[model samples]
Target: MDSPPFESFSRVLSETIGPLFVSAIIGGALQGVIGGQAIYYFKYNKADPLVMKCLVLFVWVLNILHYFLVVDAIFIYTVNGHGDPSSVSRLTWSDIAIVLVSDTGDLAVKSIFSYRVWRLSRQWYLSVAIMTGALVTFSFSLYLTITMIQSPSVMPNAVGTFGALITLAISDIIMSVILAMVFWKRRSVFPTVNRVLRMVILYSLETSLVTR
Candidate 1:
């Protein structure tokens, strides 16, 4: 068979996708470090340390995934010297392994966070609803990632990473809204409402714009 178009795509993808993912990794790392520190020091009565730890895990996973996506994109770009599809299609098992590991980490964070919320609220109705919603969103995001990577052909850029990033932004918004309502109802006991409120809002807005 004729050599597939890989070189050209690689060059363009590398130049653009590589830098974008690198930037995302930097941002993710910074957020994880800063947010984790805040959670450690702030002593938010409303936040369970276990739940907060899950949030930190989520952030850490984001950074790890960011690095994985960037490196994979760069490698693929380099391999596809001039858009040759053959080598691109020949992705080693290691590549799939990396993606699988990161995907698992992503799911673990989601599960932990959902369990955390359920444990904290102790409200079956609300907690079940939140967990269900999170699961649905996670499924959609994963489907998007797989479709982008393996269908038709290999994507020149990191489509799965972008989908995950968007999913996170949307998830943050949903979670923030729920937490805000809880805080509003228990304002008397939850003195750190303002801080948690700010973090949720900032996380929603800030992550919404963060590209991967």
Candidate 2:
């Protein structure tokens, strides 16, 4: 039996660029969801504050740019590199940029949701803490990006990045727990709207976990 041609080449490409390729596909698909939500908000949310609308638009823009960067990274490794697997190991500007864009978008989203928490419960402390965690997460991502630029490896030491992710997850869990409790208490206060409050409690926790 003859050996298959390009077997080693295929393995190298799969190992080096597989995750990025898959991530870009998933991210592109989610962009459609995000776009739909943005469109609905713009069409139906005339009563929203100008600042709020602007913030939403800003986040949407960041998400779009991030998606582009992700695609550009794939192009850089696969297309631009002439299908050379070793090209994936060389970090590109798009790779570094995606990190900053992603982190900034996350911070913006957390700040918006934290404001919602404040509006519902008037708990300044919790909102502040969540924002603090988001900031910390962004800071760590920035550090990781810088480290990637300085290091030789495509995936650099990510301890700070991982710690930031853990902190962000904890913050989300804490926020959801507080939100559920607040909603639960309100269920007793407004008996007629109890069902709606209970649903909100479930939704908040479910969304938090799903995002995590």
- Pick by lDDT: which candidate is best? 2
- lDDT tens per residue, model 2, 1-212: 22343465577678756887898899899999999999999999999788778889999999999989988987887788864645755778888888789889988888787787788789898788778888888888888888877874557656867876887787778778877876775666666699888888899899989999
Stretches of candidate 2 exceeding 4 Å from the true structure: 1-9, 152-154, 188-192
Candidates' C-alpha lDDT: 0.56, 0.81
- Worst 10-residue stretch by lDDT in candidate 1? 85-94
lDDT computed for candidate 2: 0.81
The digit string of per-residue lDDT tens for model 1 on 102-155 reads 555555555655665566576666555556555655665566546545653555
TM-score for all predictions? Answer: 0.54, 0.83
In terms of lDDT, model 1 sits at 0.56
Error of 1 at 91 (Å): 7.0
